[model samples]
Target: MDAVVIGAGPNGLVAANALADAGWDVLVLEAQDTIGGAVRSAEVIAPGYVTDLFSAFYPLAAASPVIRDLHLEEHGLVWRHAPSVVGHAFPDGRAAVLHRTVEDTAAGLDADHPGDGDAWVELHRQWTAVRGPLLDALFTPFPPVRAMLSVLRTQRAAGLLDLTRLGLTPVRRLGSENFGGDGGPALLAGNAMHSDLPPDGAGSGFFGWLLCMLGQDVGFPVPEGGAGVLADSLRRRAEARGAQFRTSSPVTSVTVRGGRAVGVEIAGGGSVRARRAVVADVVAPALYGDLLPRDSLPAGLLRDLDRFEWDGGTIKVNWALDAPVPWRAPGLAGAGTVHLGVDNDGLLEAAKDIALGRVPEHPFLLFGQMTTADPSRSPAGTESAWAYTHVPSGLEWQPDALARHVDRMRTSVEEVAPGFADHLVGEHVQSPALLEEWDANLVGGAINGGTSGLHQQLVLRPTPGLGRPETPIEGLFLASASAHPGGGVHGACGWNAARAALATQRTGRRLRRALVGTAWERVLRDPRSPR
Candidate 1:
């Protein structure tokens, strides 16, 4: 085979498709009996309801150039959006809803506070001014040289220093400084909490602002039928391009010869050779320690992997409701995604609890109304809904404790939607262990491959001096969420890896391999150096 992809997740599928599009022979091996990793959906909650097992909304996917350029829509992928992108409900039954248009969203915020709406409009203006280049920088490879230059070129059009300052600001401060009301601040802080980052953490402002702006640009959309439909669309596109897939095939380890990846060893007792490359869509720990021989990796690289930080653990609950969620706030009814049961202070408190390794009494819930986004998710008048919350990483999650945490999530939802539980016809809970069992990439229930914190991001991701896909081993590449740009359904990691492999093929192999090895060695020599 020209390339052997170790996993059949979205990233792996994207990689296979890219290599195949390049006219390279490609084979994808999946450990699961079925493909789609976290992007798959099923009717486990109820006979008529299709519940997304992991992720539901796809703002990132909708905006991703890599995913969009694939034209998956041509392969039976239809995007559907709810009337409202996101809704945040207050305790007093009032809500802040993000509409597709800036005017509508600003009008809603203006109702909360007179001048806050104008402030929101200005924020969106700044985002719009630089959205293209900014997104390019985000999804591009590390050092993002050309993308950064594009962003710099916009300095005259948009205030470069001001954007830089805002990007580095904490979400808490970003909100307080920009708006005069709860609506604006709640939206910013709530979106920031979507990740492992607390509202006060550095760079939280950028994430929060990015998501909020994306909601305006492209509504938080979903597949017309189910999330699995999106995965299937990608699969169909790859297959049309002649990429082969093998399910129930687990690659136990990557075989190396003379410091170059040659093939992968299957679990039972077989091996598949890769003439060109082996793209691994697994997490960092599994690749660095479990799959590859330890002696093949530099001792310094192993030490850096030891410090690899994973984001918080996650617990998801899926429900098939007999009726729509009886949200007390009328505005929340039409939103595809909802952030509820927490205000600015409550979000901070809950974050602190999770940081301290204690489950919060009222965990903030990221609830999704699948039926709202796509009516086909369930039968007429019924709803398919799910909610998830994060807990501290490395918790035991014993039976009783897990149940209590799940209850806390339910009760939190009930606070905003008075009769939420009463409408449920069926319920399915995915604990941290269950999540890991389903997809090993979600290690310790972490949806993001690794922490999105500043310390572990950029060139420091996976390990210092290695954020791009090319690994220490020749013909080997890391194409999982653990790679650059962290976690999202964008498929940039896979795109970068495949492009890197193609670039190496065009260039001479020995010279490129020697240069890469020397670069890693030079940067890794000083463990304390951030560079």
Candidate 2:
């Protein structure tokens, strides 16, 4: 095969599709009994209810150029949206909602706080001005020279200095500076909580702002049937182009000969050869620590890996409800996703607790109303819902501990949606360990591949190396979210990796590989080096 893509996650499948579209022979190997690593869905929550195992909503996916270019809709993929994009439910019978349009969102905020509507409008206006180039810069590979140049050219469009200042400011400060009340600030802080970043963390303002604006632009859309359908569409499209997939085939290691990835060793003593490239959609630590031979890896790379930080562990609870969530705040019923059971200050407190290795008394929950987003998620009159919260790392998730955490989660929900528990037909709890079991890349249930904090993002991601997917080894690329641009449903990570692999073929292969090896050494030895 021209390429052997390891781990059939969305990134891996995207890499396979891109390579196949390039007319290269491609094969994808999934360790699990099924495809769609974190994007899978099943009826495990209850009979007739389709619960997304991991990620569900996809505003990022809708905005992603890589995913858009494939036109998955041609392969039977359908996008569905709830009436509202996201809602932040307060303890009181009030909610701050982000609607599909800026006007509606602003109106909601304005009703909550007089001047806050204009503040939101100003923010969205700034976002609209820089949206194209900013998204280009984000989805492009590290250094993003072309896209950055485009952004610079459009600086006057949105005031580059002001934009930069907002991007660097902490979300907590940004929200307060712009809004007169907590309603608008709560939306920003809640969105920032999607990452491991705290409300006060530098560079969190951009993430919060970005997601909020995207919600207004595209809405937090989901597949019409289930998230798995989106994955299946990608697979179908790739298969149409002749990309093959093998499930239940776990790759033990990447076979490297002469410091080049040549093939992969599958379990049960089977192996597959990749005549050109090996794109691994696995986690960075697994790729460096377990897959490759230790001797072949740069000592500096291994040293840096030791300092690799994952996001906090997550506890996800899925429920098959007999009816729609009896949300006291009626505004929340229309939202596909809800940031519930906390306010701005509460989110900050929870972040502090997670940082201090203590679970929050009232965790900020990222709740999804699946049936609200897609009616097919469950039978009529019922709702398929899930909520997840971050906890400190290193919890054993023993039965007693899991039960307690689960109850804490339920209580958190009940605080907002009064009769939440009464409607539960059944529930499924996925501890950190269980999440890892289903998707190995979700190390300790830390989603977004790794920490999305500024310290660990951009060029510093995975390790202090070039944000590009190319590793020190030739013909090998890191296509997982651990690469630059951390997490989300967007396929940029995989697209970047596949494009990098293809570039090797067009360029002088030997010379380029040798140069890359030299650059890798310098980067590994001195992360600050610009060799």
Q: Which ten contiguous residues of candidate 2 have the minimum total lDDT?
A: 522-531
Q: How many clashes in each candidate?
A: 0, 0
31-117: candidate 2 lDDT, tens digit per residue: 999999999999997789999999999989999888999999999999999989999999877899998888888898999889899
Off by more than 4 A, model 2:
526-531
Every candidate's CA RMSD? 2.1, 2.0
Clashing pairs in model 2?
none
TM-score of 2: 0.98
Against the unseen true structure, what C-alpha lDDT does each candidate score?
Answer: 0.89, 0.91
lDDT of 1 at 433: 91
Looking at model 1, the pairs that clash are none
Candidate 1 overall Cα lDDT vs. reference? 0.89
